[model samples]
Each structure stands twice: as C-alpha cells, then as structure tokens.
Target: MRSVYVFPGQGSQHKGMGAGLFEKFPELVAQADDVLGYSVEELCLRDPDRVLSQTRYTQPALYVVNSLTYLDRTTERGELPAAVAGHSLGEYCALFAAGAFDFATGLRLVAKRGELMSRAPKGAMAAVVNLDEERVREILTGLPFRNVDIANINARTQCILSGEYDELHDPRLRAAYTEAGARFVPLNVSAAFHSRCMTDVQQEFALHLAGFDLAELTLPVVANYTARPYPTKGYADHLAHQISGSVRWYESMSWLIAQGHRDFQEIGPGNVLTKLTAQILKDPLPVETAPAPQPAPAAVRARPRTELVFMYGGQGTQYHQMGRGLYDTDPVFRDAMDRCDAAHRATAGTSLLAAVHDDTRRGRPFDDILTSHAALYSIGYSLTEMLRAAGIHPDAVLGHSLGEYVAATAAGALSFEDGLRLVTRQARLLQERCPDGGMLSVLDSPDLYRSRRDLFGDIALAAVNYDRNFVVSGAGTRLAALQQALDAEGVITVRLPVRHAFHSALLDPIRPDFLALTRDVTVTTPRLPVHSSMLAGRLGTRHGWDEYLWDVIRRPVRFDELMASEFTAPGRHFFVDLSASGSFANFLKHGYAPALRGAPAINQFGNNSGTVRALRDELRRLAGV
Candidate 1:
C-alpha cells in the first residue's frame, strides 16, 4: 500500500484549466493573486489564447494551479503520501510540497526560470515512441548538429528529443531515427528543453537559488536528473542544474518502484506524468489505484490581536519644513537632529536641517527643499535616531524604495554616519547619471501600459507598485505620451516631484559605477530582520549590506510583494511609519488591505517626539517587559 505524489511539467498547460478551481476556492485565488501581484483568475481563464501560452505566464500559472490542486486534493481526504517526485518544471512543485521552499519563493524562482528560458535560442521538442532509450541516444549521438539531445526518457521504449528547429529537421537525423524503428512526433514547444542550449540560464539560476535556504526533503522525493532521493544539502543547486540535464523519468520511476511505491497520484492540470508513469510500469494498474487525498489544515479564523510592529521609512519622505515644531517642543529630538546635521554636513557637504526647514532659495519649488542627496540622507538618519532615543523598537523593519538605507541604519547593519554617507554618495551618482528625466506615478495597472504598447511605446513602467498602480518613468516626451494615453482611459496620472527616472532601464549605465562605490564600503549584518524591496522578500544571510545596497539601484522595487509577505503573519500589528510623512503608510493602507485586514492600527511618527513617545509606550505595553 505504498504511494507517492507526482507533478507534471511545461506542456501540461491548457486554456481554461484553473477557472473552476478559482471559483470553488476563493481563498486560494486571493493567495495566488497576492503572491503573483496579478489577477490569478484573469491569467488562468480569461487570457486571449496566446497570452496564456507565453513562457512566463504559462510556467507560473501552471505551478500555481498545480500547487492549488494538490492542496485541494489533500484537503478533501486525510491521506498523505509517503514520497513525491516530478518531471522537469514539476520538480519545483515537488520541493514546495516537501517544504524545502515556501510557496512565494517557489513561484518567484519558477517565474525567473521561465524568463531566462524564454531568452534562449528558439527551439522545439519531439516525442520518439516505440524506441529503446540506448538506441535513441545512439542515433542522436551521430547527428551532424551539436544542439540536439535526448530530453525526457519517459519509458523504456520512449524518449523526447529537444533542440533547434533546423537540427530537428535534418534529413539524416530523421532518417536515422526512422530507420531505428521509432515513431517521431514533433511537439509545439519554444526553446529546447533539457538540453545544453539552456546551460547559460542554468548558471545564472544557480546563483539565484543560492539565496534560498534549502532543507532536506521530509518525504522521499526523487530527483529528475539523478533519479534518486534528494540529498539533505545542496538540493537547490541540484535542482538548478537539472534544468539543462536529462530528465531520467524511467530511472526515477524505477527507483520509486524499488522503494515499494505502487500507487501514484498526479495532482495537477492534465494527466501527462500519470500517463508516462503508466507507460513505464511493468504491469499498469487502474488509475483508481492512486493514493487517497488528505485533509487540509483547519481554516484560519479571523482573530483581533496586535503584537508585531513593522517600522517603515526611507530617504525621500523628508521635507524642508519637517521637525520645526518638534525641535521647539522636544529637546531630545532637537539634539538628535543637530547631531545628524553636523555629521551629514561633514560627510555629504550639506546642512540637512536647513534643507528640511527654511530653505531660503527664492523661487525654488517646495520639493526642492530636501531634494538634495545629502539632505535626504541626513533627515533619515536624524529621524531614525530620534525614534531610538525615544525607546521604540520594532520586531521587523521594511523600507520602501529609497527607505532601505534608513531601515539598514535602524537594523544596525550600517552605522548612522556610514548609512548617511553611502546614501549621499549613491544619490549624487544617480543624479549625475540622469539630470533631467523624471518619474511619473500612474494610477493604473502595469498591464495597461504593456497591453497598449503602441500608445506609450517608448515609456517603461519602471515600478509595479500593485496590480492597478505603477510608476512610469522615461524622457519627458515619453512620459507625456503615457500620461495622455492613461488620461484618455479616464485614469489620473500624477507627476512625481523627483527629477530622475529612478528605476527605468536608463539607470543601467550608472549601476557599474555605483557598484564600484559600494565595493569599499563596510556593510555589517542587521540586528533585526530586514526585508528587501529589490529581492521582493526577506533578506537571507547571503545578502549582506554590500550586495543589497549595490543592487538596490539596479533592481526593481518590489514593495508590494514585501507588504504581502510581511503583514500576512498572524497577530502582526502596528506599522510604524518612520519617515517624515505618511506616504508609505498610505500605500500600505490602500494597496495591502487584504493582508492587513482593515488597517491594523498605524502609528505615524512623522518627525515628532510626541508620536515617537506614544509608539514607545505601545511597544512597552505590548511586550510587557
């Protein structure tokens, strides 16, 4: 009575696959939407044919639906399998089911893998039936082209060849396979799967996987490349390399059979893997022999509890008139600001307090008050230090966009002086790279800009804040074109006051220089947990300050993902806004309503000592220390 769960790979996708599942399970839909930052239902059901078939959409969509199906099946009955395994793309689903990586990490990895795979040379795949594995390999070995190879060895008499289209069409190779008594059927696939053509992508994806923590599989999960159980260590690396390696499906099934596993359940869209398993088994049993399902965890009941505190702030939230009243009312805050101003002027060559308040440059705009790199850095330092002096400590810290440096300083990864210095230098370098172009905040979906490519063809949606809100930036003409297009659609677009296209591809030129500046800076690990907007998740031990700060400029700011992951933890409460104003706080309230569940009591400490004191009292009361 031994049983195992198996997952399917790329070609298992079809239109209208997960529509019914989303309808039946609304919570699963919401979870998938939050993780993907899009409408899961729209992607699964309503896509206009080819859109769903794209590599990026297809891989993630399949993974989501497959994982959800597994959940649903297991929840319906109370039976857990003794082991798990999957084909190429399905290997991630296996690891996720085994708890090696969480759902979000798995989704992100699959998405990135799909993106990299799409960039490979356009190729195709073919299924060779009624052929021995050794004979197919021998025939492929004599091929004239260097691109072709045996991709998936599904059964003893079946294998799939993946390579370039031209190589697949080679008369000599096709004739050799035909002569070897095999039936060849070409598959409708883009890019050669499980071939050396994917080597370049495999290398990069390995580095990405290094950032994740890979634990041993709790269940006996077979590997597609080695056709054996996963090793406790280096499973992530193994999975990455499996991309370009041959999928030993026959050998994997043999190993499972050796382990006394008879019944197999393929819990995903399509029965591709199940059919393959049947073909491989010596005596194919009825599909009814599949393992019984398992019951799900009890539904999480909504409870009103508040304990965790998330502090938010960053550089851009500073203003010239900020802390004017605080300086008069609170001596501690005034002294902290004074110290910050002196240190900042020494390193960044600017008076931060003057920039935030009483900027006497006539005819200058209000945004220009703290627009300088030095001014923003100094204000962030001063504000964070003021909070610390007022005795408020957060359980976790998240910074939005430029606020990461402030969060680093708060976490003790970067000293206040060093954080200010780095921020000032980084800001000045970015400003120098693009002096005129600015960013525009558009209150519309990024898909709108992507869909209507002709209207704002030149403009790039730099930041995807949420599904319906984004920040578009480029040259003035391009920005104007995009704004006009949105206006025509009855969407209001607001121009950001900053004078740089912050996250656009235009900043690519400046990244190398910025990386050079960060090379010599000392970056220590943070005392508290810090989530990165660049990586769209919590920072792992591998991501030190040096790597995080340098790449922050080049990578897209994934603040929306951060909010979704951080606030979803149970009993989490009190997001403390550490910036000069409540800009980020407002974003959280509106963008993350589902995660926060109706605003879990915000504490806006906008450069004021009274607000800081109240937050400190709340923390002390909650902690009871």
Candidate 2:
C-alpha cells in the first residue's frame, strides 16, 4: 500500500504533549533527556505559565516529543511508509524519519533555528480563504509595505499572508483582499512566520548548518518552499532558504496526489495535515464519485540492534620494528606508508621514519624518542590500514590529542602520507618552539582558575574535559609560580607525561607556517564522516584537507564534545581510536562513562595479532558481513 508520513509546523504544540508516552516509555524519555541535558518530561509537561512557549523551547520540545512518538508507534508496528514530509519546523522530523539527518543534529539545528527565528520583528498573520491563488498573489504583490508577504497556501481556496501588524490592519488592503472573493481571518501568531520578515533569521541559520556533513536522503522528502523534491547535497540550504519564502503547501499536497500516493498519515503532535488531506480529497474524481478508501496504515518497525564495538590501541601498539612488518604483511599499508614517508621528507626536508627510528636523544629512551610526532604518525598509518584489512569501519571516530591525526586519516580527508607529513612537521615545530616545558592535566574547569585568577596567574586551563576534569599547560617557571600560589589555597595539580602546551593560545604562532605549507596542497572532500575537535561538529566542505591540517595546529582539540554528542543516540554506536596505545580509548571510557553505558561494546588493539583478530570479528558482526 502507498502511504506517506507528514509532519506539522508551528502552532500545533499543546500543554502536555508526549507526557503519556514518556510515562509509558521511560527509557525513551531518559535517552532524550540525557542528550538534551534536561528532563524531557519536565520540559514537556510542567511549563505551567507558558515560559516554554517561546520559540527556542517550543520548537525543540515539539520535535523531541514528535520523534519519540514516531519511534514508539513505529516500534509497535511493522514498516515505515514510502515517503515523508513536514511543514516548516516539522520538516526536520520528517528528515529524521527519512534518514537525511540524525536525531541529535536535527534537534540541535531546530533549537538553534528557534533561537535565530526569535530575533525576527514581531508581526501578525492572517488566513485568507475562498480566494483564487493568482488574485491573492496579485494583491500581496501590490502591497507597499516592508516585511509583508504570502506565508502558507493550505489549499487552492486558502492562503495565509503575514506582515507588520499596522499594514495587515489597513482597511483598504483588507477590503481589496475581501473584494477579490475571499474571507480574511486573523491568526494568533506573535510574529509573521514563513515570510520576508524572517529574512535575517534565515541568513544566520544557514551559517550554522554549513558545518555539518549532510548525507543524501534514502527516501524522498517534499520541499516546503518549492513544493518539489531536492537532492541531498542542497537539502540544508533549501530548508534554510524556505524560512523567508512562501510555503506552497497546496502545491506540495497536489504534487503528492498526482504521484499516485493516496494514503497519508500525519505523524506528529496533531492531525492538522491529516485534516487538510481529508478536505483536499473530499470531492470525487472525474472517473468515479467515490474511489476505494486507502488500505489500512502500515505497521512501524524498529531498526536492527547493532553492536557498538570500541577499538583501543596500546603503547606497544607502536612498531619500530614496525615499518618493515607492515611492508611485508600488507601492500596497501606499506604503499600508503611509503608515500607518507616521502611527503614527510618533501615537506620537512628530512626523512620522518628515520627520525622516528633514530635513538640519538641524549637523555630520552629510544622508544620515548620514537613515540614523538613522526613515530605517532607512522603507527597511526599502520593501525588504520590494519583495521581496513580487518574490515572494521566506524560509525563515529574519536581520538585523544595526538591520536586525532589517525582519526583524520581514517575519515579520508587526509591521506596517510599527508597525515605523516603534517604530524612530523607539527612535532618539529612544537618541540622547536617550547624546548623545556611540559603540560599538566588538572581536574578543574576554567571557571575555577578564573574565580581564583590570582592563584593561577601564568598557568592557564588548557582543556576542559568536563566540569571537574581539565588540563592546564604552561612553562615550568610559570607552573611553579602558579603551583606555589595554589598551594596556599590547598589545591593540587597533576603533571601529564611528555612536553609542550597543546590546545592553547600559545600555539597560535604555528598557524602562519602551517597555512603556508598547506597553501600548495590539494585537499579533497572526506569519503566518510569525520568530526572536528576544533569545530565540535562534523567536518564540512569548508574543511577540505588543507584547512583541516592548518586548523589542527591552531585550534583547541574538542574530541570530548564530539564524543558527548555521539553517545546521545539510543543503542549501539561504534568508536574507533587509532593510536599505538590504548590511552585514548581509556580516556574516552573514563571521561564519558555515563554516556558510554548505552554504547554497545568497546575494543582495543595495541599492536597484537589477537586484538587484530577480535577487531575483524567485531567488524564482521557489526556490518552483518
């Protein structure tokens, strides 16, 4: 049976939506609350005085409720419909169902959207019915006022015009619209929605959306503004542009009907779209006065339970004794590494692998010296290749500071050769800049340091893992000065291993050199999804290889935030940390334990055959191959 699921726009929210569902499905409610960092039930059911009625709260609240309802109802049934569509704010919900945008990104976009749209000037909306579409358009075109335009066309006989309150209240214009065979009814909306009044709001919204890696839709989604289907690459842009454009709802509905889809289900909050469908289908067709009623609604089905395999790498995961092993064992890994080594020499004016294997440091152990940037990149290259051979693909990838270069390689934005070159160059640059200092991971927020600013003078909080977990990096003399000051306040700090202040403004100087090196390189789009620690979102077209390499040096690592968002989805989500040691994997598990429990499983490989075999098995299991 042909059927489509449609979502409603704003003005459909109620006082106690999703309350009953939340009570019945506590797990779903808890999942959503964890993602949003608030009690979903409280936000949906307890806004007694309408404080939640504001656009920011209302849009997200409705979307969460609608999504949960869809999931619940669908789980109790059999299969999704053939098509999905939504009106304005509801379009995100439709995209989620269509697999265009995941739940977390959709919710985030909606929240940001509401906040942006709230900035629009206050205005009014009025529905004009029983009017010809052409004449209504002609009247609106003739209006001499700013911020006034057609908003929604519910049917061939109805349309909504929104604009300034004073302009809408003009007697002559109202009479002109009425004289053209239509009835005008004022609406209760606070601002004119879906009109030029919201032009500024739409512009800001586009910038935020530009950062995400939006994939193609697996199913068709009817566009609101154009009343047509849009390709995946431009979906986000189309949705943002629709904010100030007229919503051709009537045209959209007619287009669907013409496509031979007779069965439609309104899936969120209210049955507004369903009611409109009934009205649109009331008249008999030319062939018959009455056509057979559409088949019963199809049952909804839940997605399969996929295993969450977390892969960790250990210190021994390093190989020195490594380059030859990869060369002999896998051609792909060896070729990639060879190319990387060549790039390293070309960019840094030295052989990176030779530097990594060199044991000439005065006081440091050979392994310690080898584990520097050059060595790390070589190991990262080998590990990623090994995983590919084992058939292990990640749904999401995260890495600790140094390990992030590995994740970038896996995501395809950076080739193994390019990664090694960049890492080698970065390590040399950093070591040269700060030859005698080290970083300390303090378990405190920046606010703590800020509150007692005098006590932590010179020693700045480098990274914020969470409220209580932080990393502070500075020179030894500065650190000593700050430690003496903090000692008086009874606060202690732990020193991290190795050297150099990472993820601090102190690294700013590296930008110019890094940019110069990247200016001559050709960067391409990522083949797989990769989150940016610097941007706290998936890397976009703007972050092609060149920009990413430069940003890696200048920006603060933000993998923690990326991990936080990844764990928000219900059920299993895989995370692979490509490093020589399991250090990054352990850090992630400990740092995000609360969010990790819902994650299905965790795995690690520190240059071991057994771990490699296990990773292969897990990959096969997750991919059902």
- Clashes in each model (backbone N, CA, C under 3 Å)? 10, 17
Residues 1-625 of candidate 2 have per-residue lDDT tens digits of 6578888878788777776677766765666666667776787788765756777778888888878777776777777778778888888888888787777778888878888877778888999988856568656644434346678877767789898777777787688888887898988878888775675677677668778767678877877755656554445656676777667676676667767778988877778888888876663112212221111111211345353433322222343444444445567666666666777677667765665444454233333322356666666666666566655555445444555566666666566666666666666666665444546655555457656666655554545555456666667677767656666766676655445655545665666777676665544544554555554444433233555665553444445554443233333455555555444545656675544532212122223445445556655666677
Q: Which stretches of candidate 2 lie over 4 Å from their true place?
A: 1-339, 349-351, 358-371, 399-404, 427-437, 443-451, 466-468, 480-494, 542-547, 594-625
**True-structure Cα RMSD, model 2:** 17.0
The true-versus-predicted C-alpha distance at residue 570 of model 2, in Å, is: 5.1
TM for every model, in the order presented, reads 0.52, 0.50
The model with the greatest TM-score is 1
- The candidate 1 region of ten consecutive residues with least summed lDDT is 292-301
Candidate 1 residue pairs in backbone clash:
74-294, 75-296, 77-294, 77-295, 78-295, 79-294, 314-403, 320-356, 320-357, 321-356
The local lDDT score (0 to 100) that residue 49 gets in candidate 1 is 47
| Model 1, span 442-512: residue lDDT tens | 77776676567677665655566666677767787677777777788899888765666665567666767
Best by lDDT: 1
